[model samples]
Target: MRVKDKIHKLKILRVKAAKAMHADLQHELNAMHVYCHLRGFIGDRDALAFARKWERNIIYSHIIYRSINRSSNA
Candidate 1:
């Protein structure tokens, strides 16, 4: 494949990955909000910890998205 085609494919893949990441983050945030609201009622510390972990995952996904964007632009 030509360099241009490879680059284009990479760009498309990057965009799809970014979109999926954003969707995942949004879903996580929504779940987080629900968990926060029910935190007192649930009384399960483990669930809260899981939510926090998901939040961290969302952050990591954002970092990956930015890194891919920067590298692609360069």
Candidate 2:
């Protein structure tokens, strides 16, 4: 395949991977919230908020890693 076609396919794959990551994160956060609620350790809203903060950190790191990789490749 041509370089351009390969780059296009890679971009598509990246998007799909990002969407899958987001869905997986959401499911995990929901489960965490439920577990915390059942254990009476934290309120539902608080648990979700905590999970979301963790999620943001993960996403931010992923973005930084991607930028670093792009720069190094270029």
Candidate 3:
């Protein structure tokens, strides 16, 4: 896997990343709507796991940044 492919797996996307930012969640979830689409089914679920983990990290950082701005203003 290339350094960039690990992020969003655009190779599977139909429109590519140039359009808009959506599906910022698990690729499996985006594909079929399940948080752990391959948690146990696949012995090595690293790719799906990586996508979900990064999605969560991005969400967490956004929340934390907003909280910081709100606190600093108050």
Candidate 4:
């Protein structure tokens, strides 16, 4: 592709990165709600496991999003 096309594509990627970050944040928030609900219903060990799983998901998404943002900025 041409240089201009590459730049344009990068811009689109940046926008997509931002959108993905937002979506992940929303998903994480929803997971938090579920975690809270589960805390009341499930045993402590089960609740803790679910919380850890969701936390890892959120962390992974944020890491990916941050890496993409940083690369796009560079």
What range of 10 consecutive residues in model 3 has the weakest lDDT sum? Answer: 11-20
Off by over 4 Å in 4: 1-20, 23-42
Residue-level lDDT tens digits of model 1 in 1-74: 44345335434533454467646657656655564554341454654554465556566778888799899999
Q: Residue-wise lDDT of candidate 3 within 1-74, one digit each (tens)?
A: 54355334433332232122343434523542232343332333665556555445555655666687789999
Which regions in candidate 2 have their CA more than 4 angstroms from the true location? Answer: 1-43
Give the candidate number with the greatest lDDT: 1
Worst 10 residues of 4 by lDDT: 6-15
Best model number under TM-score: 1
- What C-alpha lDDT does candidate 4 achieve relative to the native structure? 0.55
For each candidate, what is the lDDT? Answer: 0.56, 0.52, 0.44, 0.55
Q: Estimate each model's TM-score.
A: 0.51, 0.43, 0.43, 0.46
RMSD of 3: 7.4
lDDT of 2: 0.52
Clashes per candidate, residues 3 or more apart or on different chains:
0, 0, 0, 0
| Local accuracy of candidate 4 as per-residue lDDT tens digits, 1-74 | 44345335434533453456666566655655564454352455654464555556566768887898899999
